[model samples]
Target chain A: MRAGLDIDMPPSNDPFYAGLGQAVRIGTELLAALIVGGGLGWAADTYLFASGPWGMVVGLIVGVTAGIRNVMRAAQNWSK
Target chain B: MEESPLHPFELHNYIPINLFGLDISINKAVIMMWVVVGLAAFLLVKAGRSRRMVPTKLQSLGELLVEFIRDIILDTMGKGGLKFFPFIATLFVFILFSNLLGLIPGTYTVTSQIIVTAVFALTVYAISIVMGFILHGVKFLGILVPPGTPGWLLPLMIPIELVSQLARPISLAVRLFANMTAGHTILGVLFGLAIGGGLLIGWLPFAFTIAMNGLEVGIAFIQAYIFTVLTCVYIGDAFHLHGADDHAH
Candidate 1:
């Protein structure tokens, strides 16, 4: 049973684990934002704007903005 | 016969049941989930019932798990986070157990399924959003607009913030799903090689399988820990929004 009792400390405090966590978080944040932004843009184009690909194009741009901002904020918090 | 690495993940109904036009079939992954839950519940209950001043091994082990979870809550969300110990602890234990159980040959890996992890992640994400609004009121929207941004940038920043916010649960879901799937798939391939190869050459892949199994065990625990900690961090962000007031000079 002792061998089964491998309770571990929280990895949040360990620099290496923290770094890995941050990387995962940042990657997800950026990709998710882009996907969401582009999705919204595409939706607008299809439903409201009725433009060919402009809506998706605008959405991609918005996604880029969100992704960059997310990365910056994450980096700032990490530095702190 | 060529064995596909993904064959292990294929679902087959053990006991098919339909009620109200819903296919609620008993499958390997579902059975594994119930087994993990039952085992965890039984252990915790037994340990609790037999508590003594001089601790038994089971009692001590239970205490250690509780303490570890408590520290995680405190570290991420502080004293305020203690309210969430039950939730965080359950998430940690369930995922940990599920991962470990999957390490056993012939058992299904539940977390390897994107749907399961997605549900967990999305629930946490939804609850965090609701909690944020409840705790901070309309001011929670202020999380989108960083402090000290010029008026012109507000238009640009808000949409970006919204997109990033939406990304949280997705990342959470994909991380667990990808990790579990990749690890198990590799193990499957290695085992296939070991079995298919003749006894003489089989020893080589067999040796690698042993090492990979050890790594998967460690990964199972690590992934569970990561999921729980990230959930805590999201909850903490909701409660505090630490940088919401930081002004750029």
Candidate 2:
């Protein structure tokens, strides 16, 4: 009694919306990774180690790398 | 009177209740959630009540939404994903309704609250993590290691992956909250300009306000769609660790 069993392409079909969604997603994906990494590093610096800027520096490096990986992974999902 | 664009987001409690030192006050956002849940329930029940061969408009719309969600789950998580249909469907419907309902002027967008979105993100992430551990036991840790990584890079890759994993819920929560908050803030600014500019020069900003509102509606649908899709993808990853990796690659 139901229709629309085959509606498989709503997300990929509409370029305007799909692009907007993907763009928004990727932007935050990158930022969130950085934030998490840096936050972790900053916490370690403040709480655990009296390490003068090294913990944060290392954390930011991991954050940037993770951010790139996230962007790449998200990009791989595109229809192109 | 010129009001800040963010003035709309302020919460003035209707009824403040403190239990065990927890403030669970009733606010616009709380009322909006009740309204959204009630409306969604009423529509869905009415739509599904008459399961006739010739489906009515509401029934068709409901079917379309269900199938759309089913397709997302199937595409990401495969046949096994059907078991999650109830959770996934509820999440999709609740978010879609909340986003659309919030677009109405004078109504609070419940999702605009970081705490609300964070709860959803945390719940989804926790489910995936718990399910992963249950299915794979110790091997769930393997998810942190991407396939085909050289042994030498294991130490470096593990930390990076850990950070990325932690970022998933953060991104999920921030994306929805930021989008809703940003969209509403733009609308508020445009509306402020429209009012303050008066009849002489207000029409331009007013027209832009209408246009922005239309765009915001589209954004509402897109944000909801993205959230559901990512939820599926994350859960699917838990279902089969390397499955999504292969598909995406």
Candidate 3:
């Protein structure tokens, strides 16, 4: 009875095998994101502790770099 | 008459109700859940009532929601996933509306409560398990055992995969709850400070509130998207789209 309401059905024999390779790729993408995000966060917290104009400059650079890294990772992995 | 800025969750405003001799305090979270359900039903009915080539604003709004959800489900989970549209659509609408509703002054955020969010997470977890088992029969657990893993490593890998699989619901629920609660509390504290402090401090807090509120709106859309996408991902696992073969990746 509940089957009646299902509108989305998986394609028959639609290469379920293909996903294994994709999973490996996704795992790499995830690791890359974590490593990049963590590395940036740490760098910002460490060397950017100065409160003067120079500190602001370094912090901004680190933030932008980290943010870009995250975006790149996401953009790369968003497709099937 | 002045209204209380404090939401129902504040302990000072708490009320208790007795049902059949069982004392259950009717918390703000419960009230908000009721409101979410009511608003969802109202929007759906209003949106469903009129069928037209040229739709009115309200009907068009509903149609837009339907189309939006349909596309998301179709795109991410494949056409086969459409069968679960009602479930997914309901989940999205309920979560999206509930999160937005909490933004209104004087309303409690049910999603902010861990219990409430956990229930949703558990529901997703249960469905994933049930669907996996039904689709794969005894092979449902086969999902945790990735194909091509060395036999000796199977013990370690399976446990890790199983743990990660279990973590899905907790992560799903906590992410939404934490984001919503943190944002709401920050907004609350800021606005409260705005009221308590003079214009100088108030101005900064007020600006922050507005910016955060805008961010929250973006978050409302994103959480819905994330929840739906993850749903597709889990369901995809059930179908073994990623290859559940014993020697698979």
Candidate 2 lDDT, tens digit per residue, B54-108? 7877888887778778878888888998999999999988988999999999898
Model 3 root mean square deviation, Cα atoms:
12.5
Model 3 lDDT per residue over A1-80, tens place? 21223332121112432342233233333443344334444555566653345544543444344334433433455352
| Model 1 C-alpha lDDT per residue in residues B94-208, reported as the tens digit of each score | 9989999999988888999999999999988887889999999999888887778899988877877777778778778887888899999988898889999979899899899
In angstroms, the error of model 3 at B11 is 6.0
Instruction: Please state the CAPRI-style docking class of candidate 1.
Output: acceptable
Q: Give the better candidate number (2 or 3) by lDDT.
A: 2
Q: Which stretches of candidate 2 lie above 4 Å from their native place?
A: A1-10, B245-249
Model 3 alpha-carbon drift over 4 Å, by segment: A1-76, B1-15, B18-24, B241-249
TM-score of each: 0.87, 0.95, 0.70
Docking quality of model 3: it rates as incorrect
* Candidate 1: stretches off by over 4 Å: A1-29, A68-80, B244-249
What is the TM-score (0 to 1) of candidate 2?
A: 0.95
TM-score per candidate for chain A alone: 0.83, 0.81, 0.42
> Model 3 chain B: which ten-residue window has the lowest total lDDT?
B240-249
lDDT winner, 1 or 2: 2
* Candidate 2: residue B16 Cα off by (Å): 1.2
